[model samples]
Target chain A: MPTKTVAGTTVEVNDEGFFTDPSQWTEEMAPELAEAEGIDTLTDPHWTVIRFMRQEFEEKGTGPTVRALGKTSGVTVKELYQLFPKGPAKIAARVAGIPKPRGCI
Target chain B: MTHRIVILGAGTGGTLAANRLRREYSTDEATITVVDQDDVHVYQPGLLFVPFALARPDDIVRPRQDQLHDHIEYIQSPIEAVEPDADRVHLTDGTVLDFDVLVVATGAALLPEETEGLTGPGWGEKVHTFYTLEGATALRDSLAAFDGGRLVINVVDMPIKCPVAPLEFAFLADWFFTDRKMRDSVDITYVTPLDAAFTKPVAAKRLGGMLAERGIDLVTEFNTGEVDGEGGRLVSYDEREVPFDVAVVIPLHGGQPYVGRSPGLGDALDFVPTDPHTLQSQSRPNVFALGDATNVPASKAGSVTHFEGDVLVENVSRFIAGEELDASYDGHANCFIETGFGKAMLIDFNYDTEPLPGHFPSKVGMPLLKESRANHLGKLMFQWFYWHALLPGRDIPGIGPDMPTTGKRSPESESP
Candidate 1:
C-alpha cells in the first residue's frame, strides 16, 4: 500500500491509486481526485452522478452499478458515458471518494 | 535438387499453408520447411474460454510438429532475420535456410509494454489479460477470488485476433456469475477504442444492443494511453480513466519481430503488405502472407486466414507455372459469437458486406447474426473441425473464399 498526497492531504491508496480506506475521504477532495483521474471540470451533471454515487455508497455500503445508475439517476447510458467516459460507476465512485466499486464488468 | 518452400510460422495460418502446399507439390518436386520458435500450438480462440474454465489451457495446445504434414520439415528455432532478396532466412542459431518461395505466416504478438503503465506494479496481481496462456490462467484465479465488483474487458485497439472475443468474454462472464447466482454482484463493461461495439456500423448496432440487453455497459472510442495496474485504472490520453477490480485486456498487437528484422518485407507495423485480393506480398511476387501477419483490412481471424489459404495456394501454383495469379479472395471472414445461455450467433461477411441477419451458406442454413443453440454447438464443434478439416487443408463443402450474398438480407430491405 502507498499514500498519495492530494490537495495538501495524504491518504492511503493501493498501487492503482484507489483509496485504501473510504473513511478518510472528504467531499472537497473529489475534484482533485477527479482531476488526477482525467476529468478536467466537474459540471452540474458530473456532480449529480458523483453526489448520487456518494449518497448510494453511504446508504448501501457500495457504489451503484452502471445499470442501477442509468435506470435510477435519470442519466441515460449514452449521457453517462458522455459525462464519465472511463465508465460511469467506476469514475463516479472514484470522484465520490469511494473505493472502486466491486463487480464492474 | 528439390524446390524449397519456407513458411515462417507454425500457427494456424502457417500450418494450413504448409499442409496445402505439400499436397499441391510432390515430395520430389518441393521440400517444405516450417520454422518457428517453439512447438506449442495454441488454439487461440480457445483462450477466451479459459477465464471461465469452459476450456483448460492444456487442452487448447498441442505440438506444432504434430499439425504439419510429414513431408514438411519442422525447424524448431527462432528467426533472427529474413532476407527475401536472397530467398534466405537467418535463424538465431546462425543457420541460413534458403527457399524458392517464402510464406510469412508468423502471426502478430501482443505488445502490452507499448502502452505505458500496463505492465507496471499490480500487473499480474490486479490487471490481467486472457490473450496469453499465463494471462488467461492467472485471470481464472483472479475471477475465482473476485467476490463481486467491476470486471472490465478492455480492447486496447482493433485488428486483434478474433475481434469479437472481448464481447464474448463479457457475455460469458454474465453467464458465469449468473450460474453462481452472483450475477447481481458483478458489473461487466466492454471498453474499446472503436466508436461502436464493433467495427462495422450495422454489426456494431446489433452487438451494442446485445451489450445493453445483457446489462453490460459499453464504453467506446476509448484510446487507452496507460494502465495503472497498481491502481486498477486505465488512463486515456484524452484524460478519461476506467477503474476496475480486475481488468481483462487484449493488449496492443503488432507483427512478429522477425518481420521487422527483414528489410522491405513489412509495413511500419511489421505486417507484410499483401495485395488484398491475391494475398501476394507487395515486397516480392514470390512472397505471400496471410492471417495476422498481413496488413490487409480484413478481420485478423482464423476464418479469414482459412479463406486466404485457398486462394494463396492457387496463386502459388499459378506463380510456379508462370501463369497469372487468381484474384478470387474477397476477404471472406466468418465468426461465431458465443452469447451465453448455451446460444451463439454466427456472422458471415466479406470486404464489402457487413454481417447481415439471415441464414448463412444456404437459405435454410443456421441463423446468422442471431443467437441459437445450434450456433453454440457449431462453435464448440469448430475445435474438432480446426484440427481435422481446416488445418489439414481439406475443403469443407459450400464454404469458399467468396462470401455468398444469396441468403443474406440487406439492411434496407430488413428494416423496410
Candidate 2:
C-alpha cells in the first residue's frame, strides 16, 4: 500500500493508485484526482456520475461496470466515454474513490 | 417428522448438493428433492471442445436425474417464482413445493438476444457461439466450412460461466486451423471487454503473452454494444468496429429468469445476492445459493460449485439444526486452461489470492500457471471425475474445500 497527497489530505491507495479507504475521500479531492487522470475541470455531469458510483459502491460493496453505469447512472454509454475517456469504468471508479469493478476473472 | 430440503435446478451445484445432503441426513431425517425443467444435463465443460470436433453433442448429454442419489426425488418442471416470504417455490404447472430450507442453484442463462442484431441475419450461419450445445454444434459445421478469413472470438460481457472457455476456444482454434493445413490463410483475433486478457494480473499477463505468441490479435476494453452479424461487424460502445468473417461470440449471461420474478431474492442481474464466504443468500437465512447463480465475485466455473458443495452442505445442515452457519467457503476456484497442442495450464486461487505459479495441492502435484502435458491429462481425467466422484459428492483424495497454499510460490517468495 502507498499513500498520496490529494487536496492537502493524505489517502491510502493500492498499487494502481485506487483509493484503499474510500472514507478518506472528500468532495475537495475530486477535482485533483480528475486532473491527475487528465481531466482539468469537474463539471456537474462529472459529479453526477461520481456521486452515483460512490452510492453504488456503498450499497453493492463494489463499483458498477461500464454497462451497469450506463444503464442506471442516468448517463449514456457515449457520454460516459466522453466524461471519463479511454476507459470509463476503470477511470471513473478511481476518481469516484471506489474499488475497481471486479467482473470476475 | 422429516425435514424437507428442496433444491432448485439439477445442474452441477444442485445435483452435488443434493447428493452430499443425502449422505449427511438419512432418509428418516430429511427428504431431499431436486427440480429442473428437464432431465438433460449436457456436461457444460465439454461444450468447450465441441467446436473443434473433439466432443460430440450426443456424448455429453445425460439425464440430470441420473446423477442424483436414488433416495432423492427429482422433479421436472419449470420454476415459476420463489415466494421467499411463504417459504415455498412455485412451479409453472401450478405446483407449490414447500421446504424447511431451499437451495437456489439455477445457473446462469445465455442472453444473446439482449444484444441488438445478434440473432439477426447471419446468426447461426457466419456468427455462432460455443457456450451452448446447439451453438457449439453449429459452430463445428461453420468452422469446417471456413477456408480462410478473419475469425474473431468476442466476449460480450463478463461474469460468464467458465470465463476462460473463450480463451481456450481461441487457443484450440489456432491448433484446429493449423491441423487442417489452413492456418496461414486464417487470421484469428480475440476481443474482450476487459482491459486485459483476463481479470487477474499475473494470469492475464501469461495468457496475453500466449495469445501474442500464437499470432492471435488481442483487442481489450472493447465493450461490444451491438453485433451486426449481417454486416459482419461488431460495434463497441466506444464506437470502434471489429469486422469478422466468422464471429464466435460469448454473449452476456444472467441468472435464471425465475430469479427476476422472485422479488427480494436476486440482484439487478437476477443472480442471488449471496454472502461470498457463507454461501447463504443475503435475502433470507433459509435460502442459499451457489454456482453461477450467485453474484459471489468468484469465477463461475464448475470447480467453484464443486468446492462450494462441501461448505454449502455443512451450512445447510447447521441452519436446519439451528446452529451457527459456517463461514468457511473462501471462494476457492481453479481452472485448467487448454493452451492448444495437447498441453494445458492449471490455476488455483481463492478470494484473497490471485492465480500464482508453482504446483497445486502440493509441490509434487501438477504445474500451475505453466503449460504442461500432465496438466492437460488432468484436464481430460477431470471429466470422468466430474461424473463419478464430483457429482456423487465423494471427497476427492488430497483435495479439500479450501484452496491449499502449500505448493504455490507467491511472488514475494520467488528469487529475484
Model 2, B1-416: lDDT tens digits are: 89999999999999999999999999999999998999899899899988999989998889898899879998899999999988999999888999989999999999999888899999999999998899999999999999899999999988789989999999999999999999999999999988899989888999999999999999998888889988899998778999999999999898999999998998777889999989999999999999999999799999999999988999999999999999999989989999999999999998999999999889899899999999899998888989999999998887788999989988788648
Candidate 1 residue lDDT tens string, B1-416: 56788898999999999999999999998999999999999998899889888899998999999999888899999999888898889999888998888888999888898778888887877788898999999999888888999899898865688889989999999999999899999999899977689888778899999999999999987877789887888876567899898888889787888888998898545779899899999989889999999978788999999999988888888887889999889989999999999999999998889899999897889899999999999999999889999999998777877898988999998995
CAPRI class assigned to model 2: medium
**What's the fnat for candidate 1, on a 0 to 1 scale?**
0.00
lDDT agreement of model 1 with the native: 0.86
Superposed Cα deviation of residue B8, candidate 2 (Å): 0.7
- Provide the lDDT at A24 for model 2: 93
RMSD of each: 14.9, 2.1
Candidate 2: TM-score? 0.94
Interface RMSD of each: 14.2, 2.0
DockQ for each model? 0.02, 0.53
